[model samples]
Target: MGSFEFLLDGIVRAFELIVTLNPYILSITGVSIKVSGTATLLAAMTAIPLAFALSFVQFRGRHAVITLVNTGMGLPPVFVGLFVFVMLVPAGPLGFLNRIFTPEAMIIAQYILITPIITGITLSAIKAVPEPIIETVYTLGGREKDVVLTTLLEARFGVITAVLAGLGRALAEVGAILIVGGNIAYTGSVGGIGEGLSYTRTLTTAITSETSKGDISTSIALGIILIAIYLFVNVAAGFFRRQD
Candidate 1:
């Protein structure tokens, strides 16, 4: 076939796969959402509280802590993956848990990778709160807890945006998960295709694997799904910012 014909054929096949909700594609997409979604939730929980503490409390080495968090925000995903891999490998410190190459391991790696991003953004959000607003809370017989709650409410939109940012990063990430997740699929075939449901195979890793195998249709389908996820996250973030 001509080049144009080949490209058109691949697009058609990709559309078919998506329209039919191909079992393999659906499974991989589900895994991607589950791992990234869980990681984003866990990171938000840890980050928002830490952000509030950093913003409200006075403590020694606070600058150092802030610096560390800021630095972590730009950490290389591959490095984070390597760090997690070392800690989870058979001879490594947390190896007894035997989580290496598991979905749990992927979650842990992604959490570590995105926690700082969320925390840093959340910290900025809280810091952006007007001092007078906080003072007003205190002036009205509000305790420290009340002040913190008030600040959080004021920055709720920014915090939500931070969470969405983290989710977008997690969804687009491939290197970290590849290192820790092993990107392995089952050996058997289904519907005359290799391995219907992947154990640790996510959309990003599956895209790489499919493209390498010269399965252009599958790769294109997965890429489309990934882009859709990223766009959704961005739109949500924008909506929250507008509300603010």
Candidate 2:
């Protein structure tokens, strides 16, 4: 076949796989969504409050904390994966949770990987708020909670950007999830809290498997789906910002 014909054939095969809703493909996609979504939610929960505190409070080592957050922004996924793996080992303190190789473990890893990015970006956003506005709020006898809320409103767009950055990190991450969750599909026999939990398969893992198995068309299909999801997320974030 000519090069163009070969490309067309690959596209056709990928489309067939997608249309067929192959169980394996669907399973992987579902795991990816669950882990990424949970991670993002957890990161947001932790980071927002931490960022607000860092921005508004006068505490010792606050600068050090900010520096640590900035450093964490560049944390390597593989290293994070290794760290989580160790912590989840049988002798580890959290080992009793039996979370290793489960979706929850993957979520924890991704949460750790994304939380710092969110916190750092959010700190920047909060700090970008004008001192004048903060002072005015205080002058008006606004309580600390009111001051924080007003500052957040003024920096809403920046905060949203931080969230989007965290989402991007969560969605794109693979190594931490792979190591912590073992990238293994849950069989019916594995009983526990993680028994029915989605196993570690994700788009990245699916693509890796397909490529390793020489299923180029299937790998391409997963890649296309991953790209589409990322784009959709970015567009959705934009819409939310515009609404705000």
TM-score of each: 0.93, 0.89
Q: Model 1, stretches more than 4 Å misplaced? A: 1-5, 234-244
Candidate 2 deviation (Cα RMSD): 4.3
Clashes of 2: 0
Give a tens-digit lDDT track for model 1, residues 1-244.
9989988888898889889888888889999999999999999999999988888788998889999999999999999999999999999999999999999999999999899999999998998999999999999999999998998899888888899889988998999999999998877775455776888899999999999999998898899988988888788778867876
Clashing pairs in 1: none
Model 2 per-residue lDDT tens digits across residues 43-156: 999999999999889899999999999999999999998898888888887888888888888888888889999999888888888899999998999989999999889988
